[model samples]
Target: MVFPTGSLVNLIAIVLGSCAGMLLGNRLPERVRYIVFCGLGLATLVIGMQMALKTQNPLILVFSILLGGITGELLQIERGLNSLGERLKKRLKSNNLRFVDGFVSATLLFVIGSMAILGPFDEALRGDRTLLYTKSILDCFASVPLAASFGSGVLFSAVPVFLYQGALTLFAGVLQPMLTPAMMNEIIATGGLMILGIALGLLDVKRIPLSNLLPSLVYAGVLSYFFM
Candidate 1:
């Protein structure tokens, strides 16, 4: 059995990057960090567009997003995620004012990207770790400035990263027999839209409630199973 090596490696990279950032303190300039984030955002945008283009069923994709967006809003998934981040911040008893911000931002940044979803699926379905490996390197760099600016709270994001991706990997393994190539393509396309939103947020263009769109992935799969 192939382990979820990708997530484990990603978790370690985040931790190490956070520690390095904290150690470096204010040495890393704000402008440099900002540029790095911008570069990441652009890269994410390109990746998302590519993934979105893979869908063979555009109508199903639209319906999945619509239905999933409604369900997610009704459930207040984004609010719940923010509330969880705030709770963790309080529980940690850290005086850092940016603790919650760091935790929430890092969590969204790491989890909302296309790689986060597709990488796990690949690993579980085909034992391929290429995307996850690439994501790990990108995330390691991303974590450094996040920790530098937001303090140690950035490290906690690793927890959610492991939990979210690890669960996806396991779930994908279970569904491997049922999921067709078309289903996978639709699911990835839905995730790509959410990733585009995240990219906008990272680029400081606009903030979208991406967590609220999580259900879109499920909708994509269901819609594909039935219609495609």
Candidate 2:
């Protein structure tokens, strides 16, 4: 179970970006911070749109969302995550620590896309770092704005990204056999739609319960397994 070097590099960049953002956030004016957020929102939209266009199976995507949303709702991922963040915040007891919003938002922003999952598989099995490297660059830039808006809590998100992608990459050998090209494409497309929702939320166009839809990615994979 060996993880790719790209995952490790991505993790480092995220941590560094968050730290840099936190350090510089205090010096940035409110207007600048607001503009950064807007920039992030637009970037997210562009990425999501591009990813969405890659899919040919709309039915799979729709069904994946339906089943995945149900699973996520049952699992109570949003509530559970908020509870965990609240507990951590309380334990730390730092008035400056607003952990839940930043941590959750940043984690989703970094992890809920096609590249996040696909990158690990690509790197671990194929020794290709193109997607992961690109994702890391995007994450680094995104973190700057996120940290400015959310404060130090954004830095903590690196923990989840590391754990999630590291585990995926480590197990890439086992999963590689089961994952096919079409399956991977469907999963990426599903994640792209989710990322679009997140972008809309960031832009304040609509507030989507993205956490509740997290199971959709799993559903997409399963659906892909059956169909692809």
Candidate 3:
């Protein structure tokens, strides 16, 4: 069994970054935060596009997305995520208006990227922490500005980071033998589409219920296994 040491490191990084941001947050200009956020959006958009373009079978991608979207809608995954965040905010008895926003936004940002997906896979399959280590550095810096903007709620995002990435790492360990190169590509492509939507939301172009599309990655893998 593979231990999620990388995710542990990521969790620690987020905690440290959040604490540092809370200390220096007031010192950083809002304009600086805004510009940094926009930069992250642009970079995420490019990365999403690059990952999406790796699809070997467009038909499989389309069907996977369609099925996954429908499944996610039925499951109400986005609503559940929001409700969870809101509940956490309420339990904390906090007055921060952006608590849920911060929690959800930071969770998405940390969870949606290619590094978030591939890093765990690499670690589980080959015991290589290189990708996850790199992601830890990136996420650490990203959380600084996010925590500065969102306050203490950004710190809580680390919980989901641990859960999601750790789950992926465990599942990858079990599924390593079954996963084909094509299936992996399809899964990544599906996640890429979700990331693209997330980028658009960050850029203020549109808000997509990316959490609702989470099942798409599963569908992509299933379809790729049989069809590809």
Candidate 4:
């Protein structure tokens, strides 16, 4: 499997979007920021609803959530994340900036979706960059609103995006034998549903503790192993 140059492209987009959003964010008024946030919320909700309808197996979804939530809770991902954020804030001396929210939200948005996982696999296996290209575009757009409200935190998300996707692409070469097409599709669909929940949280329509379900990806992979 070959690595796609698209990962580099995606990184470039995130940096560009963050810089643009930060520059423009300073000029925007509070009202404008509020409106943008509201718009993002709505967009998130729509995205969530759309993805939530993709799953054909409700049982997988149910068990995935249960198992994943337990694992995440035990791992204390949320707390660890908050602690990391607090350290960053203290180091930067930006305690009032709410960097944690932006970092966590943007990271989740960029990483927990079907495209984020599948794009790397496609790129490595087929030298196809289409999925990643599309995802990069969406992330670029999403960064605008996020930057408007969250300052440089939205831009910082690019770091995790790079690490997460880059690692997946790198690992794809070794993992190829385990990932069949049917398995990949199921994983994508499962990830899509998770992204839907993330979208809902972003929209403020529902505050789903998505971090607690991070293990669903693993569960999906396990299920795929048996079913595929």
Candidate 5:
């Protein structure tokens, strides 16, 4: 298969899944939606904890987040993402919390995992799209409840999912030297931190501008290259 073709399939899966979820959601009671969202949140926290545990050095993760967060805030990355999400929201005439949460949470879920990293690289190096295709299938199913609980904003998340994984697939050769296993672990660990915040937001515990932390993934990789 062509490189990133799997990502295309993945995108299709998420879109179809979201459509199905939206249909199903309209029939569910508000209380049931709330319960499902909470369960997803708790599950997210558990997943984040598991990824975070991959880090060999917590200090590296900490530094990557602090520094990368500062950079992201300065660049207003969250504002940029919000603007994009808002464009879609305005088109739908929705200013709902679930919409925003769905977009943010779906993007995080689809983009943060090891599958995202390995899928693209494997495709580039081995002409193998198995991992990405698998991820797409997984995302397809995962997007259902997320869209059901949140809203159409979950559909918009497919944009980032495509860009992130697609770029990695196309550029894997150039990035190979930089993306060491150690660095990959740190990146996942940093993402786990972001995922934790997403979980809290979903649970109604507290709101987190998790988008602003996106740069930490890059920063963690850089730090890992030099320090690890």
Candidate 6:
């Protein structure tokens, strides 16, 4: 069996960081946690802007977003994700801005973007897990502050992170061939826009139903195929 060391390390980092954050949270004042959220929001905006700017053609992205949004709405993807988050929150008996809050936010933050996709693809193809390793470190630090405010549910994010990237990594040979360079960039752009939405939501400027746009990632590729 090909050991997925990169993914395993990423999981370990999230768990450790979350646990450490939880411990630190117990001692830190609530104000400190709020500050962390604000900082993360600013950082996310910067990152999102960078990714959004990477697209060579703006029209393709606009169409992709519009179509993807419609598909997501028709499918009720956001509602399903919200329902799942709420149910898990109830089962865990978590209170305030924790549990479901952390899970959804952290999962989206960790799951989308180019690194989450391309990193695994490269790892499987070239045995170079550098991008994933770098991402793991960033996630470790990010998770700490998130767990401080969002609660232990942040730890559960590792589940989606591992599974999503692992699947991509394991099947890189098949998927990579299907995604042309242009398609990949468009997909990354869409993910960046979603990440930007997540940032805006975090900043309390708007409440974006980001999960509703999950189909946007795939739509980006499709749209790119035609535009390319």
Model 4: per-residue Cα lDDT over 133-196, one tens digit each: 9999988988887876776677777877888888888888788788766656556566667677
On TM-score, the leading prediction is 6
Residue pairs in steric clash, candidate 2? Answer: none
For candidate 5, give the lDDT of residue 6.
78
Q: Where is model 6 poorest over a 10-residue stretch in terms of lDDT?
A: 1-10
Write candidate 5's Cα lDDT for 150-173 as tens digits: 889998899889988999888888
* Candidate 6 runs further than 4 Å off: none
Per-candidate TM equals: 0.86, 0.93, 0.92, 0.89, 0.92, 0.94
Local accuracy of candidate 3 as per-residue lDDT tens digits, 84-142: 98899889998878777778878987887778888999999889999999998988887
Whole-model lDDT, candidate 2?
A: 0.83
Identify the runs in model 2 with alpha carbons over 4 angstroms from their true place: none
Q: Model-by-model lDDT, in order? A: 0.84, 0.83, 0.86, 0.76, 0.85, 0.86
lDDT of 6 by residue, 9-75 (tens): 8899999999999899889988988888899999999898898887888888888788888998999
lDDT of 3 at 207: 84
Instruction: For candidate 1, give the lDDT.
Output: 0.84
Error of 4 at 149 (Å): 0.6
Q: Show model 1 residue runs off by greater than 4 Å.
A: 1-3, 121-131
- Model 4 spans with C-alpha error above 4 angstroms: 1-4
TM-score head-to-head 2 vs 5, winner: 2
Cα RMSD for candidates in order: 2.4, 1.7, 1.7, 2.1, 1.9, 1.5
Better of 1 and 2 by TM-score: 2
Return the clash pairs for model 4, or none: 41-203
* Model 6 residue 144 CA deviation in Å: 1.0
